[model samples]
Target: MKGALREALQRARVDKVPVALVTQLEGGAQNLVYSSDQSNAEISLGSSQLEEIRDMLRVARSGMLPGDEFFVRSYVPPYRLLIVGAVHIAQALSVMAAQCDYQVTVIDPRRAFATAERFQGVELCAEWPDEAMARLLPDAQTAVVTLAHDPKIDDPALIAALGSGAFYIGALGSRRTHGKRLERLTDLGLEDQLQRINAPIGLKLGGRGHAEIAVSILAQLIQARYGG
Candidate 1:
């Protein structure tokens, strides 16, 4: 509630950085702990307490530590889903992602497929995949999925997502298709980053329908987010 702490929290929110506000229950003293390199000089925490705070930050959970002497309130950036190539699978995925509290955005250069009528209540970007990814600057809290299936669209977005800190990167493709895609990406000098992509995007749910595929993708994405 102090001016300095308030400003730090505001900055963290703006920068999409995860942090925890730790308040001592007895003395009412407070310290801010960031999940990354940013730190608060006002108070120094022991390694054990720092690790506990980090665990809370990872799960975005707020609660008292083991001793109940301090309460940690987690403040994490909103989870985001950026779907490249606003196609049929994207329509379903967007809806599902929104239901799971993701701020969903569908991007495509083709205006016809990225229309609001089709992707109701979802953010639609009418720019090319690379352009949109560059502007969005996908962060650790963001997930990028390529459902466009077109190399021209999916490849650029994959390249951008691979280069970013986006936590999840998935592409819809068959095993054979993914092999070809991998070759193409390798040719583009992305061999090292290829492992980060969930190529046959989604769990092996054995569901072939668009909605079922969406479910599988969401399941895998949640697993990735939770380190499952």
Candidate 2:
């Protein structure tokens, strides 16, 4: 029985999705504790557990709720941010996004700029725009940013982003530049998506340069992602 329990836990951890491990511990107030994180799921003979613990865990495996923490922690997934450019704005936004609980990732084919020396502590990927984006397509909790104004970099990145479930899709640009860019996107059969993007990106802050502009950009992005 112990060996089977261990095998089942190993498989659950290998699957990498959250699971509630319910177990009864011997004669203690905390006997009914259930573990949501696999790291804390361990059972030792002398360590003490109720005999019926395995059955409780079996019920949980069938998708039964075990406890409050099990429902709250295991069910909530991490928020993800995929920045499609390792530019200066990305440099600033990455830090801000991390502070706001986003798992930030940066993708740019330029090895020089994408290196750890520049992006330090961020998921920097030196891959082609669309291909790099394919691996990080947005979900309900995802937000995307295209900091590079260059079409070779920004266009394809935005194309892949707009086609996904990303809650927020922003491209840095001025209103006039947005007009010209829109014409090009429409010519390329991306007008519908062009409308979907938060272009002339950022709120009406009337700011310039990298950092402050990034602040405005992030403000607008978060608002679009979470606001009504």
Candidate 3:
């Protein structure tokens, strides 16, 4: 890595901008491609290949050809898992998310259950969901989940997360429960954004335990991340 490329990568990381590096095989000429719509990039890579590079950056993957002159390396933002609950499922999900190399934050207004003793080795925000999410600011690399059965807390957080660039938004509820939630959101003028949410919040794993449910949710999150 040259000094310029290293500095550009550092800037992109600090600014939370998704960028891709294309390096020429012969002269080692390098170019940085940002994923922001406002950036009208004028690089040697064709418009079609640049679009593909953007998708590769979204999934945090590198693209290389077998006998091509250039290779693309993605510099995406870090993966974040924001859980708007402090329940048993959140405890299990937090641990699993950490294992999968996600920066996990658990937010809940109930300080009693959101204590450090319960959620060990994870970031805890005892503030209300809206306040905590305001500070957290879910981005394109983030996955937001609401495991708090209380709609008062989960709904507000969902509204905030849905408005942000978080790649995944999920809620833990049955179909009937989700329907009620949807009605509430619709009444709040969030009907247009409802399709972005993944309710019932997990793969059909046919198990009801906290750990099992955590596994299913994490599986769905992986599918969201990798587009599987």
True-structure Cα RMSD, model 1: 3.2
Candidate 2 local lDDT, 110-225, one digit each (tens): 88778798888998888888988887667767888887777888888888887888888888777887788788788878877777788877887877778888888788877876
Candidate lDDT scores, in order, read 0.91, 0.68, 0.88
Model 1 residue runs over 4 Å out of place are 1-17, 23-51
Clashes in model 1: which pairs?
none
TM-score of each: 0.83, 0.68, 0.80
Residue 113, candidate 1: alpha-carbon lDDT: 94
Candidate 3, residue 77: Cα displacement in angstroms equals 1.0
Return the top candidate by lDDT. Answer: 1
lDDT score of residue 99 within candidate 1: 94
Q: What is residue 187's positional error in candidate 1, in angstroms?
A: 0.8
Model 1 earns a TM-score of 0.83
Q: Write the per-residue lDDT of candidate 3 for residues 20-105, one digit (tens) a residue.
A: 88777787777787885413233477777778778888778896834577788887766999999899999999999999989899
Error of 3 at 91 (Å): 1.2
Instruction: Report the lDDT tens digits of candidate 1 across residue range 1-228.
Output: 688888988898899778899888786778888876445544566889889889989889999988888889999888999999888889899999999999999999999899989988899999999899999999888999999989999999999999999999999999999999999999989999999999799999999999999999999999999899
